[model samples]
Target: MDGSDQGLECLRLLNEIIADFDELLKEDRFRGIDKIKTVGSTYMAVVGLIPEYKIQPNDPNSVRRHMTALIEYVKAMRHSLQEINSHSYNNFMLRVGKSAFN
Candidate 1:
């Protein structure tokens, strides 16, 4: 295998990792979550972006629900990354930062 082959292999592995993340967005639990974009290996998503899932200003429960969903999604992403790491024999770490804004 030459340099180009190794590069292709890396891209293939990255595609696999990204595809796994994309599949998570399709799950019912993550229905309202939207994939914003990916910067290199970073996966960006947002919750309550859809009108139906938007948080209600007067409803505290709505805010809690969205926050809960976001945490669960983050956990799922970490789990997915672990599975991918196991299969690829690569160690990948996830760093999560979350915030809620009006």
Candidate 2:
């Protein structure tokens, strides 16, 4: 494939990956987290950015719960991506980073 073809193919693959992530994130286990945006291969999400989180910001317990939820969501996301890449033998790996705002 030419460079243009390869770029399009990469985008197509990324779209498929994003679709899978979208479906998985819809599960009840991922509530309160929202998809921010996808930049190239990077996927970003925000936790405690919803209405429920507005009331949770002042509570330490709520902060801890949000942290736990974020961690669990990352774990599931990595697992989901692993499963999807394994099928195509692409050996694709996903790295996660987390930041909390006060």
Candidate 3:
């Protein structure tokens, strides 16, 4: 399917997953990956398309950015779930196949 279709699917799935974590998060006891893992992966997939970077050999920056983004998204996911904060995971925006930012 096209990116739009896939993106919509992702949002739908994200909402479902987020809802499932409603209780675990309400008490601030968020745990496990089943519900949150897929959402993180989906975030990577969507961002990796153009502005997102992925981990690759000999690309420390890329890997670094990817990990950062992963972390931010994980944070954002929790924030939205608990109504705590907001983030776009921009920390992961890295240029692939390049070692420098310019």
Off by over 4 Å in 1: 99-102
Task: lDDT winner between 2 and 3, please give it.
Answer: 2
TM-score of predicted model 2?
A: 0.82
Error of 1 at 55 (Å): 1.2
Question: Model 1, 1-102: lDDT tens per residue?
Answer: 999999998889888878988998888988878888998877888888888888777899987887788888889989998998898889988888766665
The number of the candidate with the highest TM-score is 1
Q: Is candidate 1 or candidate 2 better by lDDT?
A: 1
TM-score of model 1 (CA atoms): 0.88
Clashing pairs in 1: none
> Of models 1 and 3, which has the larger TM-score?
1
The prediction achieving the highest lDDT against the true structure is 1
The Cα local distance difference test for each model comes to 0.85, 0.81, 0.43
lDDT digits (tens) for residues 1-102 of candidate 3: 999998996676556544644444343222211232333534222223232233464888766665566455466565454442223322322222212332
Rank candidates, TM-score, best first: 1, 2, 3
Model 2 over residues 28-90: C-alpha lDDT tens digits?
877878899999888988888888664275699987887788888888878877887887667
Alpha carbon deviation, residue 30, candidate 1 (Å): 0.7
